[model samples]
Target: MSRIPEIVFVTREEIIDELWNKGIESAFNSNIYAYTWYLDIVSPGWSALITDNYDYLFPLPTKKKYGINYIIQPLYCQQLGLYSSKHITPELVDTFIDNIPSKFKYVNINLNIHNKTDKHKSDTNSRVTYMLDLLNYDDQIFPKYKENTKRNILKAFAKNHTITTSLTPSEFISFYKYNGHIESPAKEIKIIKQLIECLIRQQKLTLLGCINQSNEIGSVALFAENNDTIYYLLGARNKRIKSSSLHFLLDYQIKNRSGLGKTLDFEGSMIPSIAHFFSGFGAKPCKYLNYTKNSIPASDLILRLKKELGL
Candidate 1:
């Protein structure tokens, strides 16, 4: 009989070092969300589970509501789950899932793309992210773009729209909020702003905008890059010239960032319209899992009521 891998909850003091070491060992751990600095900004009191020697790890971004401790998917973070330096097997993933502490009564989080487990497959929800490999730049890239996307890009060019990276975070946020793209509460927006500032200070943020001859900002997007991927974090546009400005802005970004050999992650929307838009740029669908489990009494009932009420 084989011994079960002993998983231990890491203390606050140990998180930074472990996360840094794991990131250096595992490519997927390059995601900024899992880093201590980023977590400190968005999910302040986060912790993790780790096997001895840090071969396998899982970050648990927790919160307390009405005295009930639960895990949640943090804002601006797309995924958080098992991260490993070695090949992850079904048994390994299952072991990690089973070991999550029972103190967390409500758990809802998106696992990283590298994580897969048959143990709780049915309880997982699916979401698709779009990624474009930038190696096929210049000559080979634009040809892959959907015909409609090409047309829109040309239209923006014909209209003499200019692309610029001079927009500040505050300006972009103001534009995003005014365009009704920000539905988050003021507090959440404040957190997002702080995250943006931190990434900017690290020189990991790219802000792009499409402006007309009249100097009007038609569309803007914020792209944050880590070691492996350039994430299309957020975007907003003025309704007046929404037709081709966004298409042009995105194309310009891909073109400029191409040949760098990193993936462009369309940090996504499950909405059909948004998915279709991402597909137009030659990005393919990459699926990930979201897991949820409720252990608290009445939690399931409340969730059922919320679903019924469409809340």
Candidate 2:
């Protein structure tokens, strides 16, 4: 029987990318790479973030415990080799951990679905993140959500709202401006543009657009589809979208794609308000570890020295 190959470490630009590519190939979200790159732009530290996604390869910061991590990329990683730190156990993980330069206090976070093989559980010390499993999945459709979501969706439908999908820059801008999804979404917005461009170049973006006929306010549901999963990454509609039905437009896409994989990942919920927004969709929580080992003393010392010198 062909066995799963041991994950031999490779170049940050090479092996790291293969790993990321593997996850993206398995239907991981495209926006993950952008956030990963944002960290690189914001801090640009000892980020050992490695990934194949050309537009996104950089370190991001974490507000975790006492240390930092070189987050290469974020993903809806399902497979062990691609999007998970599941293989880097306490015993063998040290090798990779030791290689990491300590200056990068930003821990890497890879949110993944829990399967039987993932023996490692997340903790405070690790750079892992939690997950939200989409419930009532069916291969042909998104699973059943709570009554409130159903009503919202029904309301969107009942209003005879016009819905369309796009990855066009104009459309994205429209969506951004319409819903005031512009502010406080710098990293996310930047990545959305990058992903839109990348997917458009590859002809792989399946951006969904919805418009309320009565108000002319446009709602957008941005999604990327692959063989295994469909990620409902971004949703935006103007305040005119009563009850925020644009969320429903996006949720409908998730429900339609639930049965396609073992679990549907609801990216993250850093803010309680946003968490509440995603939670209402009925996905259970999942988490991952953000493991770190400070190997680069020189980098760490330099960063510390710089901070002290005010340089």
TM-score of each predicted structure versus truth: 0.90, 0.60
- Which lDDT tens digits does candidate 2 get at residues 167-205? 467776566755745545665556556666655665545
* Predicted candidate 1, C-alpha RMSD: 4.0
Query: Candidate 1 residues 152-252, lDDT tens each?
Result: 99998998999988897888878877763656669667886888888978789999989986789999898888887899988877976555899999999
lDDT of each: 0.81, 0.46
Q: Evaluate model 1: give its TM-score.
A: 0.90
For all the candidates, what are their Cα RMSDs to the real structure?
A: 4.0, 7.3
**What range of 10 consecutive residues in model 1 has the weakest lDDT sum?**
21-30
Best prediction by TM-score? 1
RMSD to native, candidate 2: 7.3
